[model samples]
Target chain A: MSETRQINVSKSQVPKLAIIALGIIFAAGLFVVGFDQGHIFSLVYGEQAFTDMYLHELTHDMRHAAGFPCH
Target chain B: MKTSLFIIIVLLSGAFAGLIHGTVNFAIVEPYLDQAIGIENQNLFASGEEEDTTEFWVEYEGYRTWQKSGQILAGMILGISVGALFGIVFALSRNALPGNNDVKKSLILSGIMWLTLYIIPFLKYPANPPTVGDGETVVLRAILYLSFIAISGFGAVGFYQLSKKLKDNKKIIALVGYGVFISAVFIAMPENPDELTAPMDLVNEFRFMSVLGVTSFWASIGIILGLFWRKLSSQKETTHYN
Candidate 1:
């Protein structure tokens, strides 16, 4: 008799997949948004708020890039 | 699957909402800045002649173009970074034991983090106030403060849940909490439809874009680092087991 074995996935894989998916989505979204200059302008205020969040993130990167990193 | 997709949509929407809020407030506040600075031209420097005005306007337009492009790049970077951070943190805490730490503890940790990282810096630099500048109107200011608190609060909870090894639905719950924090900005500062029709006469697109680009670039870096840390830890665990 031949038996079939089920392969179980770990919970940890979920987050990794989520992150990769997010990165792809972000990259794709930018590509689409980049083409529409008017839409980009129309979304300026929202964009600024986004920029504020990015600034905080970028500062973290700059520190790391400078070799003075923080978690 | 539905929940995960929903969470992603919510996150993206939050980012988009912030952009809209920022743009409108920027438009409104430019006039206020002009009034305060006593400059007839939207640009800071004004030589009182038609030829000077024409030259300044041309220079200003070029500057505005640069700024807008910068902002779009910044926004994309920031979104990816934040998403990556969320992913890594979630991965790391997938094994947290339930009821070991409650939401309250997470909030305290969040407060400490905020105090140490954000509040302290601002307090020390009190004189150098981090004004949103030509972007600070009454509505915008309120939204900014409220959103900061909300993001910090939810971010802490989400981080804590991950730390506790929560799985499946619990992770989504935590993400939803984070989403609420992000969405608070829009709830606090809804756009006025009437303002949309108002002339862009005072708005300098270039300056606006520059600020956006610089800010987003920085933010993406933070997010990427967080994700990297998680990925590294996970790989180490796999190697040890193998």
Candidate 2:
């Protein structure tokens, strides 16, 4: 008589939803800090946002320091 | 898999690292930024775009303070964002990474990412302080820079995947392959259209400081995340880690 052994292992699959959420966070954060030039504020404040450039001004130092192109 | 815990740890690690990055920049990089902006102010006065008057100085100081404060706030934001990406990659690649423990593996990944994502693109388009970039070419420069980063990151991942298919002894070919691929792409990419008007010494010094700030962020994230993973990843919760 031959005996067959059984084994169960959990590799712990990564959740797709978590990755998706992180991806969104990554994109939004990068855009706000690295690339935003008042476009985000414009959605609510209109053309005046371009002149104010609140977020742009806030992230200005880092934008330059982290190597994103700035004027 | 303790999904909520993973996310929390990732965000926390990123926020802390980003805080360190922002603080380091405030200490070291701020001087260079102030110097460069001073040059910009001089140019503004020369071109009659802005007057050297009390009102102008008041407004400038106010905005400069705001910008300075933003360094830390933006650092936190950027940290969480980049940390999220790092977390995702670490979770996916933990099994295959070369290290005896979580910290070492995380550090190895960080080094690889720092080299491919930061160092490589930096060589092609180094960091520039205020008064260096052209307003008209800003968009183009941004696009070029982002494109290069994307190419390097994905190319590295692609080469790594190729390496997995080969025998252990043949893995070096993948490294060589990526080196050749990235070098060719580096040459093929277009150069920055803007002329460098800033002093070579100032620009070079600013770049050195900038590298230090970013390096700090990567290293911090690696250590913090590694510690978290090792501590939280108990045998009962995540069977694979055992």
Candidate 3:
């Protein structure tokens, strides 16, 4: 393909790529939410709910792996 | 055109994501098992002989309900309002010639706007010792307000920065910064049982989750609308360019 045509093709693909990335992020988020059901409850409540649920769950899992009583 | 549409798509997608994810576990997955287990009574600790329920349970339930409803409503309103406001601000800021330092101006303006709406309220009502139901009610209400403001403000900043950095290597930096701010708030949350003035009513949790779901859904809608507007404008520009 000519350089101009290559650029056009790549430009057209940006939106498609963004959509795919978003889908992956959303799926990962759901998985995190499902895994941390208990903490999800806590995070949903007023005090702690403002925090990103995904990060909290990941941190909790890490803590558990490192032998912390995250529960 | 692409940027606006991207914003809208992200907002809508995030909202639906929140709602579906929030409901799936409680409404379907867990409830099915609970039902299959043949649960005799959900609340096992309730004393059968009690004539008047204890004030703790009563206050807890009341505050819980209030928090849930307040959060949902706040989330929806905040998400849309903030999203639109951010989009307009972003569009206007970017309209300036490239390399003009107007991005900093826009960021500063947004920061001021956020501080005025989100932070001032907390400053007005600093976190106090847990009072009776009154304290719980007050704090929960404050939290809902703060959450809406913060989400909208931070989301906008993230969106704006993401737009600017779309072609730059710093896109991840912008996204991660917002992510860290949000995660820090969660981590810093005081988890002491005493700090929780409200009782842990399971029903209340469901209610709160529902509100969050709705908020996420609407915020996404706002983003979608904003994207549409941007797309239309961009198409006009493209036609002119052609």
Candidate 4:
């Protein structure tokens, strides 16, 4: 039987990969937290008033504070 | 200081500043909004035939609930996330800017960023409450606002690049030139007014508060981060810097 070995990766590539991951994560976070207007929540809830209201309640202050449209 | 460490500190500092700013906004603006612009219901009973028609009033459950804890939490989150993103960009652009401390440089950079990224676009299309404006016009309004932001951003970068040729007061000259250019664009762009649903004063107040909250957050982030970075730099030894 051949001995198993770990996959080799370039050391310099680690930081580059981490940076890309960070960017992607942060971009998604900003979109969800700031710019999302019930689009995500609506998927599961089917565009109900309660869904919008709940999301709005959670984000309304942040939206105005961060200079995003809330109304 | 290590760049990653510096980024973390800047993000935390921004969050702190944003917390304070958000607290103030929640305390003052929330109450004002609640009292001034709480509901917008049309009169069902009163007909146009009625000689003495009273104002229509309908209390709504509304979207947002005023909660102190929620506001504070949101504020801190806003500061950290948005600040971190901006902070990274600010750090990357540090070479192009001048300053002993990255944090202090951030102050000037953030100011320029705000001017171009937000204020310019905002001037053309002032922020409205969530309930304001016709629903159909949302797309057109968004396009217009985005275009304005893009113009301001590119114009600013162009000005900065051009200012490199000038030796004396480069920043001031670039700012003046950009301001003039933005002003011209502002004048040329036709006004796209939306139907006002809320009371004018209430709408204006909300707009003012929104601008104030954002401005305060940026100002605090700059100052707090600057102080923290300077303090860290003083404690550090002679380091390898590019």
Candidate 5:
């Protein structure tokens, strides 16, 4: 009788969950740093956030340095 | 690799690389920013937009402090964002990438990404200091810049995918195709509407430092993530003898 050899191995699957999570991070972070202009804060603070522009002012230096549109 | 571990590695790598980029900007780019802001302040004063009083100086100092501190924090955030994209691409394309180790392959991808996503877009719309941009046209400029980046990136990708289907000897056509297409798009795009009022010397120097800051981020992410991926993937591949 001939015996068959079996090797125990695990194949990796495409990590969809991780990719989705990272995709969200990419979009959210890009917005906060690159082009907030008070829009994100406006979600909570109403129209006043546009004037405060807390995130925008905070990221002002970097936005310009990193080649984003900043006024 | 496990999902949680992969996410952790990608985020951490991005944060570290971004931190490096932020620190570099502090050392090399901050002075130019200060200089440009100084000119902006002078313009505001000259135009009677505000009186240069102690009160004004106090508010200015407060915001400048916030802006400066946020540089590092923002760098990390931006790092995580761009790094996420890098991680995703690296994971999917690892096998297709060339090299005996993950580090070399990671670096090659980073260079290609940096060129397609960053340098090409930058050439069409270079970084400008504060004084150079106009508030009225910011949205327009943003659209133009973003459009060009997308075109350059997708154009390169589309051509590359096509190359995979062609004979090896005919692969060079994709390269030529990308060059010609991007050149056409470059000419078609509108010039930055804002007039260059800042001193050419100041503008040019700031742009140079800006490029350096962004480049550091790309290089660090490539090395850091490559090392991490190699270590973890090796563990995953280990075989146990019963």
Candidate 6:
């Protein structure tokens, strides 16, 4: 009688979950760093008068330097 | 090496390479920006506007230092983040790709990524220097630039899907499909008609330097990751013998 080898399957799930989580976080970071040059923090806080161009200005040189459109 | 370990190695290698790439820019290009400010002021003066009254550079103090550090930080962030994404995609596609050496595969994929993501869009709308054009047209310029990226990306995907469906000459068909799609989009895309605000020579040089910087960064990441990955995998092999 031949016996079949049983493979453990549950161990693979962790990395997949981690990858998904990392992907989401990375995507958000990409957006915040690359795209959302303004109103991001204000949008998060739901504040009506907390407008700031600091982030935009901070990232301005990097944006143009990296070949992303800024002008 | 395990996939997770390999990814971490790649990410770190990529970040290190990116930091180097950023350092190159800070050393070479940052001075040009300061020069560009002066030239742009001259341009304004030539147009009969008060030269010193622009107040553009005056509004931003401490930018020189900020720009230097920011480049390095941005490079590291972009390197690791994009490297992670590359690892995931490469992991998924490894089976279908015809190569045993992961390094060669990574270089090939990096070339493709650079072409589609950066080169194509760059050719269409090269990187502009600070104060290169009218601020009013920025939104339109950005939209057009992003549209080129989307089309290139989708065209590549469409080619892949179409290649899978075709029985013969799949490569030819896919290439033709992608070529036609990109050409049509490129032709249809709106061009920025505004007069150049910065010196043409400066704009061209800055664009060239920016693209070269990105090319070096991606190339370094691919090479570094390849070396690190090979070492890690070899170590894993030896450990299994113990």
Best by DockQ: 5
lDDT tens readout by residue for model 1, B120-191: 222221111111222234334333433454455456655655635876557666556555654554355444
DockQ of each: 0.06, 0.40, 0.03, 0.13, 0.45, 0.26
Q: Where is model 6 chain B poorest over a 10-residue stretch in terms of lDDT?
A: B233-242
Which segments of candidate 6 are over 4 A away from where they belong? A1-19, A43-52, B1-7, B41-59, B167-169, B233-242
Residue B208 displacement in candidate 6 (angstroms): 0.9
Clashes of 1: 23
Question: What is the C-alpha lDDT profile of model 4 across B1-242, one tens digit per residue?
Answer: 55466656756786798688778778666764554333422222333432323332212332334433467777776667667656655655666777766666878887877878778778787877645655466546656765787788889889988888888756689879998999998888766556776677877887888788778877887778777766664333343333
Sorted on DockQ, best first, the list reads: 5, 2, 6, 4, 1, 3
Residue B133, candidate 1: Cα error in Å is 12
Residue-level lDDT of model 3, residues B1-242, one tens digit each, is: 46546556445533443334334323422332223112212222343523334774685455444433333233332343344444444444545324334334444444544443334333332222112113234334434544544564666466556757576776676666665665555455543222333233432443343333333333343344434443343333112221
Candidate 1 runs further than 4 Å off: A1-14, A17-71, B1-14, B20-53, B65-80, B90-118, B124-242
Model 3 Cα interface RMS deviation (Å): 14.8
lDDT: worst 10-residue window of model 4 chain B: B50-59
Best of the candidates, lDDT: 2
Give native contacts recovered, as a fraction, per prediction: 0.05, 0.63, 0.01, 0.18, 0.57, 0.30
Off by over 4 Å in 5: A1-12, B235-242
Per-residue lDDT tens digits of candidate 3, residues A1-71?
22221111112223444444544553344333213333444645744653534333333222111111222
lDDT string, candidate 2, A1-71, tens digits: 55554443435578888899888998999999999989999999999998999999999998988888899
Kindly give the stretch of ten consecutive residues in candidate 5 chain B with the minimal lDDT sum: B233-242
Window of ten residues with lowest summed lDDT in model 2 chain A: A1-10
lDDT tens digits, residues B1-242, model 6?
Answer: 45567557756876887687777777766777767766766776788865555364554446555655677777777666666666655555554555567687667777877888788878777777877756677667767876788789778877977887887655788888888888788788877655776768888888778888888877877677767755565432112221
Candidate 1 lDDT score at position B33: 33
Which is the better candidate, 4 or 5, if ranked by lDDT? Answer: 5
- Residue B112 accuracy (lDDT) in model 3: 47
lDDT of 2 by residue, B50-91 (tens): 999999999999999999999999999999989998999998
C-alpha TM-scores of all predictions: 0.31, 0.94, 0.31, 0.72, 0.94, 0.79
- DockQ, prediction 4: 0.13
iRMS per model in Å: 14.3, 6.4, 14.8, 12.5, 4.5, 7.2
Clashing pairs in 2: none
